[model samples]
Target: MKKLLILILLLPLLFVGRQVYSDDCDTSSVSNLNESQVKEMIGKCQKNWEMIVNAKKPHEESLRQMEKQLAAFQARLNTIASDLKQKEIKINEGDALLGKQEEILAHRVRQFYIKSFYNTPLLLIFSENKSNVEDVVRVLAYQQATTNDDKKTIIKIALYIKNLEDKKKQLETEKNQLSSLQTNVSEQAGKVKKLLTEANAYQVKLEGQISQLSARQEQLLAEKYAGSNYPMSVGETEPSRPVDDRTIDPGFRPAFDFFTFGYPHRVGMSQFGAFGRAKAGQNAETILKAYYNNVRIEKRDNLMGNINVNGYGSKSFEDEYLKGIGEVPSIWAEKGGYEALKVQAIAARSYAVSYTNNGQGSICTTQECQVYIGHNKGGDWERAVNDTRGVVIVSNDTNEVIKAWYASTAGGYTRTSADVWGRSTPFTKRLADLDGAGKAYEGPSYGDSPWFYVAWGSRSEYGNSAWLKSEEVADITNALMLYKADGGTLIHLSQPDKSNGDTWSSDRVKEELRNRGKNPYNSVSDVDTSSWRNGNGITSTVIIHGDAGDNTFDGGDYKYVFNIRAPANVHLKTALYNVEKK
Candidate 1:
């Protein structure tokens, strides 16, 4: 937060950095001025304060969100910790039961051994029966008492002990799970608690700054306005409606798709790259340039509109929208700390701004827009948001805000906006990524090259052990058939005519393929795997022969190829994939 506390960028003037307001305003109150000047000054102060307050709205909401999440996590942690204790107790009890059963079994075995060994005929004869009557009688009695029932009792005790041991092992495993869950929940709560304290302190600092300026605001406004005559327009930019404004969807960029979809920055695992650089002592801006192409970090003007916050129509800042977003994994912010999260905050801010082009809908709460579930106020995320407040990534080409689309995975190359969205965006075209050799499977983080080949199935998430089987060929065939489906059916959905250059997975493929009556692929040999970007690995294109015949389907440029879907359990991993025999 020291980054935010430092007013280096915010010092020279009021309202915005590097921007002269429609009218220049004094940074301090009580700077002597004329009557007209005073009025303008007061107006400026009030307006700037309003904007600042508006900006603070999101941060406040973010804090609220964080509090809620922390509370929930705390509750969860408590439950898990309690369960862990219970499981431990159960295991201990089971141990005690097994030990007692073991003792009883040992005692029974000793009794049976004594009864049979000492009473043997040879031993009895050598001892002279009457002389050793006491020992003989003891042995004879034990031997007589050893019945079929005694043997069954020993067997039963052993089995009972075995069952107790198994139960104990099961309880131990459960205890471990509870312990892990507790750790996760506790970490979130602890971090959130620390952050909340920092956030409150920062807020207090801001309040003090605003209060000092407000105290002398009236006198300064009066003096400035009395001296000059400057016309002021109260309503230059009309307040816009959300529905009318351009809608922006700031959501999770899927694993491969984040990098593959057009955004100038490092698409997937861009955070990892940022973290690596940040830890290496590179500043935030240096890290930003590495992933995003043609990046310009600009101090954004205050333009946040009212948000349908938490279902109530509340006026909040744009940063709130970013902080509220749950689509982003907390791990990046937690592991990488400020630097890594700073990059995320910028990307998210830019992505949100691009969507806020219009005064559109109640804040989009789903990944359909960008998942905004909200967060606890004081955390690394809040720090990241505050550090780079109002800053956005702009494309140098058009000098416009770039539509920052990102995902979790990208084949070796980022997708061309034209191919994916059918738009001719210069900046978001297919670009090369640094995919290593073993890129087919998922890794610990997003920066790694994931399998783009639909056939190279590794549902690393599910268990990292699934592959495309021959039976799934039908699904792959169907995805390809969707492209071949009479051409006009789903093409309109893509709007080839409209090109703003945004590319993510086209759900239109799935939607179009739906309700189409198709038969399952009966054979793998009958399917074609010849057309490939990389034969044994990930590729941008792959041809799946819907039919064993020579007839070809019309593919845009790659020519008739099977379009594999990414959903692993249901669809193939990518377009380029081969089916393994079941």
Candidate 2:
């Protein structure tokens, strides 16, 4: 199988036909750029892809927020529904009481007017005139109630009936108002869903583009390292999958490889659960314990001092290093509102230790490692750093500094490193990182950074899907075909488990065509939307479309079943996305 995969990867070189180059990334047309320049362009494109992928964090948060609001509105509507029913009952009772009171008080015609209101004579209507007046007197005479006081008593009853009618009207008005509020809430909720869906669609589009770009790079890489051993095995995990879910989404379609979940991640997943646990009276240790795996906090001597980060000479003291971490805002621990700052401090310190490039003695001050600013004294950073002095994260199994990678926030379900990085370590496990209210951080549209640490300066993961340009799929498809023609792997993909399935590392649709013994994707006729899965998470829909006029097999009515699973770095954001015809 491995031998077959290696041969399959080289299939592209056998058919170096006339290349139909992509307008965007036309590598074949360019000779001005040397190898370095090509690498530079690839790097820049990869960076852009990363940015696009991370862009989903805010939209996800927004959608999450809207969902929460929707839920609240639903709850309120339920309450209003109950109250409206009660109001109807009360109004009916009031109507019946008013009728009875008006009937009983008919004898006091003139007095009723004086008691209920002085000016509103129109509101007080009489059923009978002079003939009724005689009857009224007769009735009163029979009861021996001809006195003026008796007339006032009957008038009071009439006034009481008027008040009942007034109350019934007020209740009805309230019911109408509540009903209006319900309608508005429902509308807003609908709008939120629309916005969320659009945001999610945008995420999908971005992933698709990234997937295209990544596939371009992957093919280039395959061609670059076909004979040499570079770990593009038939079963190796995609390097960017689980670890880069924070960004670098590969349009991971489940249908691409029998609809399976690909490499997953805990890198960009949420810590809201841990925050929630802490807020709910769980101690910092407990919170950390839940999120971290097989880890023990150990007091250690300051790591080697004066590390070089980026271009600047970074001071090496553990506390000073903690002080310099610019990734998290300084105000977190100083404000004392969010104890998560301390946890961050410890994680930052541990990360610094892990990133200490033994060769260069330098770490990147950028997101490539963790952001670092020299001696940030803002907020209680000093205090927080001091309190957690000599603390370093150690893997219980390895007894070394663990890769204490953390992001601004996890969506909710902290991914396992195994899922994200394609290789799980004992310490890189998934945690029920929840919110203080015990809700999953990634649960719904609770978009606002409910975690206090994020409110200040921490960047949260954003977006649903990156938007794909109309021609990108075609361009990418064309590129993949070219790559295949150039003796690169064009058919069959390496599964996460080293198993083989029909998929190009870059273009699944093309792989599907090849599986049927056809030419690589010459053109994307249309993207099927019927198998669409709407979004809250990454995996969305199944795609069924017909692609005809290929090199080997010209056919139609092909159905792609996406594994409704979210493995990482594969390009199926939704089951089926839009396709551009060339």
Candidate 3:
């Protein structure tokens, strides 16, 4: 019995020992793997960062060389244009001069013919037959004068005609030569333009790379010194742990956010397959200035709220902006992407879009459709993303919400001079809160604007065509409830009507929304829209007024008011309550 008891105790001890040993081995393996991964990431990041840095120096030098070449070429082209203009003018003058010479030659030739053939021999014969010698001599003198005049006229006409014809031929030859030279110079200009375009594109790419490297450098410095300050909790998946200095690891590899949240430089159609725009030889300073300036503008306009404006200087922004604008659009168009812009808007539009169209989780933080994991310390690449907000709208299939969009922050509205032909939608208008303070719905519920009085049910015409709060709810119930009581519009704006009515039909409204394709819920909302969305996490709501005909509202006699969500107003609201658990 004593031995049995002892054996039991010993067996338990043996099991415990084995468990500890196994745990230690597993830990060792895990640590070793983590250390190796960190080291590998660090090496790759460093290589890429260094390569970008080295690339910039050469890129800048190449750009300077290209700029000089471009300047010379442009100057030569300008000279050619000027010379051609002058040559054309001279040709015109030459033609006029030739005409005058021809006229003079013709007159001289006619006079010569009359004197030489008809008068000269007759006068000579008459002089020989004269009775008085002195009189005969006088007659001979007259005849001699006529003959000499005729000979002189003939010689002058021949020389004049020959000289005029020669001059005309010479002018024609000179004109051809000038035109050929002009053509050659123009062709060279086109090539220089292409070069400038390539340089500009290369420069942009280099700068972006440099910005990324600098961000990485900053991240490394931060990691080496101060560890990431954000906290992690239990149940958190893939927690961001502090960097282990003992082990070398590259920080998180920055992801490519495919969403185009910010406005990038416009690229022309032809530049799609061309070489890098900055590679063509645009100056680094100019390209940098443009990128930063645009970043600044976007930041101010609430488009690129995530960009770090403090890192760049005004001069840099100006230089880059000019260079980018001056460059050919083809290169950037082909290679440029919206990754930077999407990252920037993450801060501006947090939790706006769920992670995926497919319902994997309740929410998504991935950069795909959700907010970007912006500028956390210990991450690589730090410059502000280029402006991309407000340029495009993010919408769902139903067109209920503008899930997200891009906009430009630059001033001097596009409608002014150069961008006159551009899209006329104003950033302020797009970004403004025009409906704030109940601007359109200030009147009493009964008298709210005639355009959208349908909410009150008083023979209102406006509410018939719009997407009601709920299809099941009658207009008298939901539509009127939204009126004077809440002072909110029941109807929303649709594409301008083809007919004379203020609102489109329900079908027409849906079709218009689909065609317009704006994500109405994308704007800052008081409450989340995902809760009410269908399985796809997308919903569209339309606010419209009455149709054109009066069958429903007495044939247009009842003018219904159009209720729209004020740009400044929040579409939804949220509240949180805390409870104590004992």
CA RMSD per model (angstroms): 31.3, 25.5, 32.7
lDDT of 3 by residue, 1-582 (tens): 234224223421101111111111111222223212232333344444334334444434444544554455456556656665665666566666656666665666666566556445556577655555456456556666665676665566556656655665665565555455445534544554554455445445534443444445434323322322221111111122222211322122110000111111111110111111123332322222222211212222332212222222221221232112211211222234223223323322322321212122233233222222322311111222233323222222332222222212111010111121122222112111012342211122211211111111111131111112222111222222233223222232211222223433444433443445421121111111221122211112222222211112111111111212211110111010010111
Kindly state the number of residue pairs that clash in model 3.
Answer: 78
Candidate 2 lDDT score at position 400: 88
lDDT of 2 by residue, 1-582 (tens): 234224323422111111211124334433344322344455444444344344444545554554564465456557656766765676576667656655555646545444435323343244346565556556545444534555565566556656655665665665565455446545654665655455455445544544454455445434432332211111111111222222333343321122211112235313333334434555556666667787888878746656666676656555455676665444333223255656666776777777773224677766557766555555565666777876878888988887787653453445565454333468766554445565553233332232211101111222232223223334344433443344233223222222234333445545654665656543444444322223222223323232443222111111111110111222331112322221
Better model by TM-score: candidate 2 vs candidate 3: 2
Residue 345 lDDT in candidate 3: 30
- Every model's TM-score: 0.38, 0.38, 0.24
Lowest-sum lDDT 10-residue window in model 1: 229-238
